[model samples]
Target chain A: MNEALLAELRAALTPARVRTGATELGLYRRDASNIEGSAGVVCFPRTTEEVQACVRACVRHEVPFVPRGSGTGLAGGATPLDHAVVIALTKMDRVLSVDAVNRSAWVEPGVLNLDLTRQVAHLGLHFAPDPSSQQSCSIGGNVANNSGGPHCLADGVTTSHILAAEVVLTDGSVVVLGSEAWETHGLDLRGAFVGSEGMFGIATKLCVRLTQNAPAVTTMLMDFESVDAGAHTVSAIIADGMVPAALEMMDQLCIQAVEAYIHAGLPTDAAAVLLVEVAGLPHGVAADAARIVEIGTAHGARSVRIAQDEAERALLWKGRKTAFGAIARIKPNYYLHDTVVPRRALPDVLRQVYEVVERHDLLVLNVFHAGDGNLHPLLVFDKREPGVMARVHAAGEEIVRISVEAGGVLSGEHGIGLEKRDYMPLMFAPADLAAQAAVRRAFDPTGLANPSKVLPSPAGCGDLQHVPEGAWV
Target chain B: MIDLLAFAAEVGDAEPVTITGLGTRGGAVPDVRVVRAPAGIDWVQADEMTVCCGAGTPVDELVTELAAYRQTVALPAGGTVGGALAVGRADARQLGWGPVRDALLQARYVSAAGEVVKAGGPTVKNVSGFDVCRLLVGSHGTLGFIGEVILRTRPLARHSQWFHRADVHDPSDVFTTLYRPVSVLWNGSAVWVLLEGHPDDVAEQAAVASLVACEGPPALPTGSRRLVPPAQVPLLTGGFVAELGVGVVHHAEASDAAVRPERAQVLDHTVRQALDPSGRLNPGR
Candidate 1:
């Protein structure tokens, strides 16, 4: 935020690239979430070297630098920390290479997720991990959070897709982890960095695996009388050995909100809805969809509707994608918590969450990636209320604890940024936390790169805090 | 070496002390402490996974016993389980299917304070707490020593095959091409392929591989072998369109002892220094 540091950053990058102007700074203040914060300065670096230069400058001045991509993150990951430097990687977007035979692509951090799929669509190849923000979220951020989409059940998460990376270390030294050439190497650094939440470092370029897009995509919408029924249908489908490309669940509140916002003709009266998509060869998709319908009906589904064309399928997804935004129309503010439980525990977890919501007298619109047990409970709260923020935070924390107790994780893909940093003890022990810290030290020893995230502050007590557990299954 | 000696003496009194075999390759590399066997000890077997060998038992001996069944003990044959797992290393191809650490379903080790600790169960998947079995695999003997490592074994492959696309002009091209045959790539020209299905399926894939390569008349490869690393395999087939330095190959082939015909030994020494700064173990120059 100092003028000297700003001048140094401007000197390293083009003056046009460094933006601290009120309006531009305003745009980088907050991510898609309701968390309010601001950055001291924001810079758009076009090249890896430019990013390194900015990093070095920040390192020299001891200014914390937070990497920001599309800012589509809902986990408060991209929300700027006060008095910190924000490195916006949007300008670094570039699809460097596509190796179809190898089924890999080396792309800059700023390339949009959807754009990668579009580029490889003609070749019958596509990148998996299609988060709802695929159209806006950057591949770099996806790598940072190890983002997972509804289709993650079949395609796997971002960590699976990432092959290698050109990372700019905290000290601004560029090092390549995991070669484009895959080997049974010394250590699986690739595995460690995938979900490290930028606490590791900035990934300048990524070598990610590209899959042969399924020959056909079949989408269907099924309605159940209760969220429990919908969850049961999911279990049945998985139990029957049918892995849909995506199995998304929506509560009545979510369906009503999406219907009002997108007008995609969702069943507003239904207690819960399941959006199912199957992609593979034509025969395989047809068989999978048929079996899915059988499972849904067996689990007490009230209705089933299959989309016939690409246009119809797009409309169906448009409604689901807009589900979070639609809640904003209902409430002035909302806190979205990403908690995951085991797949078998989906029905029970959903039931328990509903009970907790009722007890708190809060409206929680549930939308979950059912196949993976990733629940996105959108807690509607008016921030203006005296105790609303505290209550919402408490509810969010409770949801995370429940998932953990159920043998799940705090953030499946959103990651443990400042929002979830304090809750790390729920998922990891002191020694485990120390091991993760060791990895962080190997990458960013000074803790200058995106500090105060992932590892909870040392002052927090190590003793486990017991709370009302959420239903795992 | 001096630092390692000093630390070893300082912590010499500990039990189940973590000790590394070669102190090379990360992950699944066991760090073990020397524990004297019970005076009249026969064999101490907890489950099918691991057994208590003498403190001085080499990794190769342990691997042979553990993988004596129809299945293997999830460790690579080329190296000992202890040496293979020093820094938590796994074959990239086999990692998804499972890794050496995964096969270590249970382990019994002596703690620094000489307290015996048992981890994991006979079941293939156990996630009780701490995952000490996996933790010990690559801990480099920094924590508690690995007294005895219990590991789960899988049925070994009865029929295996090797394939080579001998005519490719460049080594790196193999990495670029031949995406299938996803078993192992060595030296850049020869691909060590393994088919683990029925005998008929193995024969079928061998026939397809020959057809794809346009190799000599099709036949089962009983004696033939290939050992090219995936990254540089294309180079063996005379595919050297782009010339890369010897350093890349040296780093990639860190484990293999076979020396290259054209490249000098300087690159290997450089790589050794880069990886093993302390020069504490496995000093094979």
Candidate 2:
């Protein structure tokens, strides 16, 4: 970074807001994905205006920069590139207002995901997208990834919950997409920006839609003798026209890991377990829960259990919430892959996933939002092992191929960051990729805002280079 | 049927092209060559939970086909799929079923450069690209000429009708308190609730809602409908139906300019520049 440019950036905002120390810049270099890169400096903007000023300075200096939220993104989306400045948005945290009557909240980009729900809990409203890292992830990060959670099957993802946003473009201009109004007549620009993975611009403020708390709830756990049966039960539940608040599945490996870590009373010996929750009117919820249990049993569930109360329900969810963390006990490192297929194809896709795991001789766990067919296959391996990383990458690529071949997508919730950028071609053709690139070019014509993320660069051939012929078969 | 590829090629690098459907919304732009999808291109393919159809397919025809499967697309009653998707309007039921964007699973369109581009896929959930399928929705042909679309459909409610005569203003409370309703419409003088689902669930919810409103079920009204936000309801003087929970108001008297989302103009222009660099498709509108 040029010293003159640094001085200009310091002049644009408060001098205290800009930091060049190695210690400060080091912290902003990497996110949860651990894809580290050198950064020019770290800017902690406390307000949207301050953010605009920093963006203007970066633009004036022709500097590439990355906007970062809580650094909890699993896709290395927040990992700064070499010669890029890190715009850390943690200081912008604030809930501007909450409209209890309208059931909406105006919040700054840095507001913690769970904090929004906490702020509205008094009014019996809550933000629905509960990504496992809700405790630490920022709303802006959720918007960047279009993050989904267990309840997303019923509630939809971040894009669905978001009503509007005030964003700072790369050119230092601010644009508001969407509005407090339920129907915006113009183009759905907000929808396009939600999952762009920071390539479009940085969102300074967001107006998020809130959902009312369901009056009644039921949570149940069903153990199956085979993972295929669990997948079949998920299809049956959806086919029955029942949309559970949450429907999750955990294979034996995931159950064992969670049990060893938290002792959530999961049946480790079972091939898989389904955690289903229904919420609505008391009578309706009871009816849905009964129907789900009946379907699970008919589909070869060995045992079925319902949470006795709220405490038991909370206990049931604890294991799923912490399943990712528990995988650390199984291996020092794990690459979590997010893919989605049609509900009917879930059985075949899972079978293909296990086949890949067996081929790679790796311990992979299946824990995912099964109701919507979003699978998170955690491939556990030691990074220090010589050939293990290569095999894991190969297996991950194979899984993505299977997913796309089965008429699914490259990603379900986690945005395609550096990790999956190459695999995008497996699901999209060149024309599709070019059209997406055109949208990016329009947003950041200079290609300076979070460059080299989401869409693959034009020069590189995609993941097909690594896969062998008929490998998917 | 007009050859979309040939039309796109003819208009290649053209300064302006007025894309038209049935022109139900208004008149054509002056001093510009008009291009429209030819008749008989309408086609519909319905599966268990989704429908794929030609963009020129009439919304009523699509609705009728989905109704046969006991499923329905959550769009308005009249207009072509291309028009409804291009305008991207949501009806009263958006409170339960999401907006028009939510139903859209995939779309294929011809770009200003005459190249065919497709976004999204034929599935309920996909995060593959930049969500261009949704970006095209409500774009009003400024982006591209939508040729085909795949929409997620929902099972039709076993029982559905408007139950009126309940007096309530600002029914946001009902939305926050009760189970999600298919549609909650409020006229100037009375509230009209549309309940759909299993007979028992609908009856129980409607009974509870009526109890909360302290009124009896009234007669239903018949007429044309338009959808707007709840906040804009009080501004209207005449009788109009408002979807309370979803915050969509249906009034034929509603002004299109009033709901135009002017705040997003800059971003919309930027997107238009990218998708339609030649500025030929629906040049001014």
Top candidate on lDDT is: 2
Model 1, span B84-151: residue lDDT tens: 54434444234223444445644444344333445433332222222335445544544344444445
How do the residues B11-41 of candidate 2 rate in per-residue lDDT, one tens digit apiece?
Answer: 5665687766767654356788876653333
Error of 1 at B279 (Å): 11
How far off is residue A143 in model 2, in Å? Answer: 0.8
Q: A263-325 in candidate 2: lDDT tens per residue?
A: 778898999999999987676688888888899999999999899989999989998999988
The digit string of per-residue lDDT tens for model 1 on A280-329 reads: 54555676788889888988888898998899999999888888789988
State in Å the error of residue A249, model 1: 0.9
User: Candidate 2, which segments miss by more than 4 Å at Cα?
Assistant: A461-473, B1-48, B158-161, B169-176, B211-240, B245-256, B259-263
lDDT of 2: 0.78
Candidate 1 Cα RMSD after full superposition onto the native fold (Å): 8.8
The pairs that clash in candidate 2 are B226-B250, B228-B249
